[model samples]
Target: MKGKNIFQEKETHKYDDIIHLPHHVSTKHPQMALSDRAAQFSPFAALTGHEDSIRETARRTEAFLELDEDKKEQLDEKMHVLQEYFSEKPEIMVTYFVPDEKKAGGAYVTHRGRIRKIDTYLRRLLFEDGTEVHMQYIFEMDGEIFGDTE
Candidate 1:
């Protein structure tokens, strides 16, 4: 029994003296709002727009296609053929490259519409619906109107 009492004395924690005391409150500064306190522990992003930058970098774009001399000649011939049928307003499909405003590369877009006019000054094919495809950007032209030309 005496040995047990000695063991209990040795086990007495150092904090036992102040453990029952009241919690200290700051008098200099006012108590923080619950929301403000919670905000301190909330997750914070140090790098703003970092995720957007990464997404822009990862976004894919295609390089513009350059036509060979023979291909360019074929396209010119097709344009002439289109001009010949301009009165009929033939429907055609044209694939062209649209440059990306933000990046170096671009994308190919295929558009189908009736030809309104071939603007020689602008070097573009104008559609009846007001869509225009630049001559230099044109990759391919196809339509049932040019069946014999093929």
Candidate 2:
């Protein structure tokens, strides 16, 4: 609604323009209805090629990230990791295997970026390049809990 008052004896409400958010895909027109459903996923989309150890690390990260700062501090001695990426809108985010392990031929590294996604049972991250990473696996790794995985 381009801020128009549609109470002029009209049964149908008149719209002007649509304001689109990052997640919103509607290019609303003054006289049109634009609806979009573009679901975003993480840049780090799958665990298909990652080593078991590195994957485990990702899993731990996923789990700890789900916790609030207080709850995270309670469980994680290295609260700094949590603090780095914890916020209403994550100031930092988790990146898996930069430069790509397949090409780099080394352990895929996990680190924090400047943007983060909302945490949930199965959350996904959206990167600057529209890359998406799944955090749910971070909660699924079954191994000895260790210091923030790298």
Best by lDDT: 1
Q: After aligning candidate 1 to the native by TM-score, how far in Å is the CA of 45 from where it should be?
A: 4.3
How far is 39's C-alpha from truth in model 2 (Å)?
51
Q: Count clashing pairs, candidate 1.
A: 0
RMSD of each: 5.2, 25.0
Q: 1-150 in candidate 1: lDDT tens per residue?
A: 654677566678757888899988999999999999999999988999999999999999999978899999888889888988889999999999999999998999999999889899989999989998999999999997678777
Segments in model 1 whose C-alpha atoms lie over 4 Å from true places: 1-45
TM-score for predicted model 1 compared with the true structure: 0.69
lDDT of 2 at 131: 57
Task: Output candidate 2 Cα RMSD.
Answer: 25.0
Q: What is the lDDT for 60 in model 2?
A: 27
TM-score of 2: 0.23
Per-residue lDDT tens digits for candidate 2, residues 1-150, read 676667763534333233342444556744333332223332453776567757655542211234466643433442234444446333343434333333322223454444444344455555445555554322221112223453
